[model samples]
Target chain A: MSAATADPGNGTILRAHRVTKAFGGLVAVKEVDLEIPPTSIVSLIGPNGAGKTTFFNVIAGILDPTSGHVEFRGDRMIARPIRTWFEPVVWVTPSVVAGVISVLVYLATANADATALAVLAAIGLLIVMFLAAIVRPRWYLRLLATAGVFRSSRPNDMVKAGMGRTFQNIRLFANMTALENVQVGMHTKMRANAADALLSTPRARAEEKASQARAREFLGIVGLRGRAGELAKNLPYGDQRRLELARALASEPTLLLLDEPTAGMNPRETAQMTQLIDRLRRDLGISILLIEHDMKVVMGISDRIYVLDHGELISQGSPDAVRADPRVIEAYLGKPAS
Target chain B: MRPDIVRVLQPIVIIAVSLVVVWLLLGGTQQFMNFLTLGAIYALIALGYTMVYGIIELINFAHGDLFMFGAFVAMWILTVPLGMTGAVDNPLQLTVILVVVMLPTMIVMGLLGTFIERFAYRPLRHAPRLAPLITAIGVSFILQNVIYSVFGPSPVNVPQVFPLTRFEFLGGRVSFLSLFMVAIAVFLMVLLQLFVGRTRLGRAMRSTAQDREAAELMGVDINQTIAITFFIAAALAGAGGTIQGLYFGSVQFNLGFFVGLKAFTAAVLGGIGNTTGAALGGFVIAFIEVFATQLGYSRWSEVAVFTVLILVLVFRPSGILGQQLGERA
Candidate 1:
């Protein structure tokens, strides 16, 4: 199932090294390490407020870690804040020093034209700094990245690098039709740009037709065979969940992160979703990282499980091993009667 | 009446009333033609305000000045570069010259818009909303000052390349210039609608507007999409500016201030985030202004426009075509 991608030397598809996220004074995810092997289902399970979602966010590049780094298939996805220290020194220091000198010279010499000249130079330097920070030319990024001093990855970057994700609370474009939602998910795969679209070129029209067909096929896979024309907001709760899964699949991601995919479904729907999840790994050969509160689904489908309690990884192993571990039991069911 | 019935009849009733008023006040095709031409220009400029606001939820106070700058660009191309001071009678020659002037002006203004967005607004994207707004006003002032220093405060004469050929239509006068202006505006607007509705980048834009994080997770390059939005909006404003110079025969540094206010008013009236709404709002505003001036309240026209704006805000807050509550998450 995992034969589609070249082996990354290591067996894992994703690796997080001591990732920590702090929101002001509160630490949400603390020094958590995780790995997802090729074409495997890995579950992160714990009681509510155990930092599972925060850890999920850190891995998906939605939130930056307070420290440490994440790697995907041997490529660095994110790194620590080395640039925060290095940028000001290289970009801002000269401008500030020039500004200060200009002020001092204006007071000491009382020559307005000279002061203006100095101010203009300072402004020019500041413009250069602004361009550097905003434009972020490839050479500058490569130079810093090679030195292990800077690495930045936005969520789009992660998606382009073969990662796809769904939210705990569904985030569909409510006004868009179901088919359009799926087509938008295939944004990275499309090639027609503004010019082609404006002119209605043959290639653009052909791509549009192809994507519509592909989008409908995805909808059918999720058991939504004919609901593609309905607005996403108009779908029932169960169908919306399925539609979200269909959208995530449209990205052709090598690794998929499902944040509580069956969070609000009934028993029958949950069973269906669980089967779908299993079939996804078996058929599509994509690794999945899941956060689940339902113990039955986790224990039934996960190849491995990690337990988190109060932002700490308490135990990790095969699902049966985790179910038998005392630390996992203590985290979920409290200490034994004494 | 039932709510559904009221919803169905409301627009029809408003249209009937507006037609009666326009017929009684304007009373002539000449004045109506003026309304259409003015409406077209306003619609083009209003789109810039509506689109930028839709994508980023930024008011973009500097957009009006970008239109003014565009007018200056056209002026420079026509007067300084091409050395044409007056209208060319050859229709073929005029058409060619118009194309020559418009393309560069629009492209230059479009690039300038992207530059401003990259420099001024992108840095404050994550800052509090008010920060980018202030930066927009600051950009507006800088644009005004730059134009003033170079061109001076007086209104500069522009070549009205579009000939004022008049013909009688139903007991009133119609100018070829008016027809040309309206045709161009409608054509560009249709092109814009097709692009936004059918293009890949356009879908990315709509998704980003709905949920930025979700769109990013779908692999939409958020920054590039935003820059493109600014480019298209500014380019449309540039076209509007070119039309203004050709129609009115003059350009000024302060030209954008009042016209921008009216175009902004149009956007708010039609619905700030909806493109069709902005275009509709522009024409409706032109009708009201034309009616007011024709009825001998020319001095009070601005007062009338603002009064209507305040009323619309007070009553419907969401303008005519704004999204319903259920559409928003």
Candidate 2:
């Protein structure tokens, strides 16, 4: 990256430098460098087996590069802190439960089960104890995860970080409603737990209501608001794709990765998605990295394009430049096409 | 169309039908009702197995042993002079004491789970499915052996603190102790489901369970989320263990071995990862025993339970309530 062009002072939030991966004999990703500056659209174009997924895997920490570094938001997502205190409540509380178990045992055995009726009576009491779990304390003691706690927040919290994604095959939480599906995508933004849900806390109710509103807004953005309550998998193919996008944007991610966003859509849906990708950049200032096979979709929406062949960056330039490159033509067509 | 009905009525129908059949065939309504509590208790342990497997897809073979550990921890306290029984005589005091005592055992075993995952499961995370599973068996062995070392091979009495009484009502016998077991077990299962389904860690769990790599890319820390999951599930097991120990008034070195196997069957029977399914699976297993015993096959009750498991696996393969989506190894 030119110090003058892709300046760190500017808003380049993600960076990968000469990243490479090899699997013993086969080189998966070979010295690929990428800079995803803020508020811009970039497309990584390659045919199948171009190692695009592997490259994606490396930056995302799903795979460690044999050589190179990945930095997100100026910090390594995998960086480990030396030390910190967590679980303030873990030990203090457990000892108490242990003490109580002991006492309960003492009393039960002190006189107990002179008859089968006694055993039956104990069983009855057990049910009552189970019922007691419904009680959600106003202050349910929560410990920071030894590894990651705020990190431990539900998938619904995805929205708070403004982050979301779509699977190549569209893996929506199948059991959830279209509305609930988007709501789960926004799970990170919610502030409630099972206790609150079970107890029906006013705050929980309000959060649930707010989540519904947010879900509706996101669905409407992708023209699926009407299908908000439907089963996601039950939707038409194109609609499911749109709903996936809507769900992703619901998190308001600063950068969105669309994996094969146009894979199964028709020309109409593809055209619609192209416009939506552009509108997202213009309207929300949200940057996006689209993985697409359709050259039309990639050329139509990408501000800049990078072509990959066998995990190596073969070309990077304006769409017109990429289209005219001999290597790019060969990578796609397997020969220079007239 | 009827999420509520399906969610609520389905379990009720299965449970009610089983309950009625057990009552009618067990040769006594009172006897079946009494056994219902046993189902509830086993349901508690099964819930632990199911919940843990639901998120991480690990059977936690040592979980049954964790329950055994809980009983011993409580027994250690019960045998002491300042035990809960002596300290708290009233109902409310007894309640407070119970929570206090059970809390430690749960935490200790929960940590034990975290350790198991960190030391055993973590290294083998990306290995073949059998790797972590085999480690779990190793853990089970280690825990049992440890128990043998500490408590001896013979059965140690599980001391009880709560005043328990068995009484007759309208030609039916009722065990207050059994009811307590039911209450505690149910409380744990419901509480856990809520935690997993609604909480942040729970969401992370679902996401990781779905696609761990994708989840981590979404800025989810899979390791931390998994550790938390193990902790919560083990804590639940600890509760079950302590309760069972105290209820039976005896825990041997091998207490968890048979029960663990039964609970695993229950986990599979109800649905591997479904929380409600686990609880349901537990009750189903208990009732199976009741009916088998009535038919003079009490000695083969274990065989009967596994037989149902084999049939279910051979047919549905997803258990009664599990989904194929989550069936991946």
Candidate 3:
């Protein structure tokens, strides 16, 4: 049966068509179809162990789906059955070459014949490997991967593609100051090489100053203006949650995925967080995909709500329609005990 | 006073007290100077261990071996290619040889470090923690054996290029070599601190160390950041190795094994992920060793060092400067 889809006219920023994620014997997410429209807030609500997190993990590039696909702005972010042989070659060739050189050097040293030449040869091989890996010329990587290497896009790639996310449990850089955490979030945007960093070059310093200014601005946007100097770990629970939001925003994403952003928060904090979520979309003009447990928060802010049960979407509609659906209620309350 | 201020000053106070005690026991500034110089060497090596551990939580048993490789690289530059044997009387020539040897040696060792991480450590990054750690031990063995085979399992005498002049200070003589070594080590350490504290990549490193998954979510390339960490740490260790060879006037295949363990202890002692702590720990370890030797307990120096390590671990697992892992809300 064809899934009842969201309005495609509103400009779908993110779409997952029949996405499934399995862990050996357990199918954590099965044939889940979702659509997130631009400049809109959509919520995904499910019972405990209903595969909400697993689905989130798949779209965020943390876990690859067993089948199906995830797209952002019509560009595929994750897909099933990755091209296999190339990845192993990309990861393994250097080691194999190094091992060969090691053995050769060992033999040459033992024989004491042209030891200098052997050592030089090993160094040469190592330099070639270094250059190849660093340059990662796509054609070269692909040519070497003739054996079917499984290549998966990393989380950083997703961020560069204008997707940012927060975790279910707050995962701030505990040791870093709030300002630095946000600066790290701006990592992809900053352009400075190692040499620039070592020499403290003018260009690198200018970039650093710019990034730091932007980081502080992000912190200010999240109502954490003066807390930049505090270590993230030392922040209170509400502030820590806000810091995570600022950090995510630092990446300057077009679409933001917030996983249980209000978990463990008091009612007042939860309300504040809900308002912040709304502000993020309205002010920033970014699409939001939210996975939240607080029904009130989700119902109050989300333009659309999708309810999942046992890894499948049981109901999808506006907040009031989803709230009134019999299937959604049954999924949450076990069919009203017959 | 605020607790933060107390926390920052506590180590300094402890170190100062320890210095006073050492001075009283040794009754000379010369031994104290020697202790500081040796401490600087350990600190350089310890920074490597602490940095890798801070980011990836790997002990990097191969680090000391990398330092040993650095020593050999320095030796090869001087003895084989440059062919400067014994003492170098020409100041300009000595300075030129040092510059030539050190730059290439650090670069080679840095590349070697990057190579080790790419080949030896990167593949096993997602494996069980113990797996990469065991691989680190294996890498250590491989490096040692490689050195042993090439250098014939014996101590290769390094030429003493620095002038043997001594500076008199407060009725005590301090060797110029010791002063130069200490200056270089301090300079590198300061550069490292700045790199880790102020730079963008440095911020990425600290974030990665704190939370790898979260760092990635923020668009930090975890693999690249980790690889860079390994490179920097390995490069520093390489520099330390070169200095070590120059200081003692000898190099050995197994030199890194004992020093590696000691550096690991220093890393642990200083709070594994804390850079300043590692440097402090290195200095502390050196002081203890020198003090033990001066007190005629030279045979028990290793025992004493280990004992302090155990005491620190038992009392403060987070270390002197280390924050308790995951302690914040």
Candidate 4:
């Protein structure tokens, strides 16, 4: 089912420019540049400890790069610019203003009561600030951004912005039912607020029904419809993987990230997973970024491949070209006896 | 029966049997009425403990103090602005007053709870578990001291606004006020259960509690969900505080110390992360407390409660209806 026609947007869907992630003194990923085109399967392959997962995490917004940035569909999703350094100060603006006001009042009025009033006003403003942070009115967020105090995108932000991902270790909501798992993935799409749910309003009820139906459809797409009622942890290994995919798909992301989708699967299961991945992209027009250890699966499905070695991107090309590259071979298997 | 069925049924059966035993021990409707009211209050507080633990895994020691704040807020609302120091003869007027007072108290406490999570817990969310745990204790002390300073270290009387009405029921006199308190408490608990079990946001909360990272990946806002959890939990504590004042007729600044510990014990007894378990734990702890006092062991009531807690911990560390088996990760 690899008959998917290229979409209108020929521009890159995801672009990472010299992304690097460091853990304290240890650099996990270094200056990695990658891109995924619309309706294409791109694979990132590397040996253990080569930072493939770290790169995946940076793309997924699970971690911010020590330097560099990532753009999703032309929107910067991850970055640590100079302005971000002012975020903490922005949060403490109320206290600073309060302190300045009280001090100024004491200096100008020379009256203790005036200073006390100023202090009280400060407390009131602090409360307002706290509430503003919680409610996060759009204007406030815009003001923060304009003041260069914006935060990097969180995982939820990435998911809401049409990116979905699964973990290499299969991090499903294990205690929840498979159906509930998918429903949770549809969290962004559900429009009901807390009040609607608490009151069981008609809008909330209708939205819930619609969401459940759609979630079930996603489960069917992943071939886990019959097991919707079963707890996620109770599912078989292959089924759990499929359920995770279903959960990811429930968000209806334009781009999907699969970390070792067929990690522990037998050959037959591996073939089926590869076919499923192909079908997902072909039928739904969703771009896929895969991190795989299996060579045959990667070569068969990926339109383009980027190989990593020791936290650095070593090679990038079409499957056959990348396979033949000497650097990729050296990265995969240490340089042969000189 | 299938194991799943047994797993589901076991908790219900245990709660039922324990309730029956407690009922048998009460011996009089008056004692039973007291038990129900007290149990309802404990249940409300325990829910806050269990939910915070469920989502962020913090034993918010300050929660009990929040309950104390709730009572004080309600008391201030009643006496200061409303100037209500006696019961209203008209039921309609009384209810209007109750709603006016209770609604504001709940909202105030809810916002306070959200604020606490923001300043106290949210920053330490990624810190070592011990850091937040210690912060919680520190927050608890802060709340207690604030209340102590404001309310003064004395027991203030709340208006007995429900009126003195009693009737014969099951060979003992039952007060109308106690019954009303129980009904309201049970109603809130049921509302909470439905909210958590059926709502989309509730699903987000549960998924978040189970796996915060996965839930975030599914677009569940962790901070918002946790803040809501804190809000709801503290709101219930507010309700409990109001009930405690109205029933007991007086409120003290440190009233939450014993109540909070007892409620925490209940949450652990019922299963720390499970909502139903926490509520069940509340009623069970109430039963044990009432039984001790009823049998003339009021001095040993704390001992009885802790002994039961220890025993439950020793054998079934997951609590009475623990969901540990499902948490294989």
- Candidate number of the best TM-score: 4
DockQ of 1: 0.44
**Candidate 4 lDDT over residue span A16-97, tens digit each:** 9999999999998999899899899999998888898889988887677899988787776643334644655776787778
DockQ comparisons of all candidates to the true complex: 0.44, 0.07, 0.57, 0.66
Ten consecutive residues with minimal summed lDDT in candidate 1 chain B? B320-329
lDDT for B270 in candidate 1 is: 91
Predict model 2's lDDT versus the native: 0.69
Residue pairs in collision within model 4 = none
Q: Residue B96 error for model 3, in Å?
A: 3.0
Task: Please provide, for model 3 over B136-215, each residue's C-alpha lDDT reduced to its tens digit, 9 standing for 90 to 100.
Answer: 99999999999988888879999888878788886689887788778989999999989988998888888788778777
Candidate 4 segments whose C-alpha is farther than 4 A from its true place:
A1-10, A21-30, A79-129, A136-140, A333-338, B1-21, B324-328
Q: Report the Cα RMSD per candidate.
A: 6.8, 10.2, 5.5, 4.5
Whole-structure CA lDDT of model 4 = 0.87
Residue-level lDDT of model 2, residues A114-202, one tens digit each, is: 43444454555543332221121111212233324222212222223343567677766555457755665665455565447547688
- Model 1 has fnat of 0.69
How good is the docking of model 1, by CAPRI class? Answer: acceptable
Model 3 pairs whose backbones collide: A83-A149, A84-A148, A84-A149, A84-A150, A85-A147, A85-A148, A85-A149, A86-A145, A86-A149
lDDT of 4 by residue, B1-329 (tens): 69999998997897688667777889778788889999999999999999999988899999999999999999999999999978898999998998988889998999999988987888888899999999999999999999999889999999989878788887888888898889999899999988888789899889988888778888898888888899999999999999999999999989999999999999999999999889889988998888899999999989999999899989998998868412534
Grade the docking of candidate 4: medium
Please give the distance, in angstroms, between residue B284's alpha carbon in candidate 2 and its true position after superposition. 1.7
lDDT of 1 by residue, B122-176 (tens): 8899999999999999999999889999999999989777667789986798978
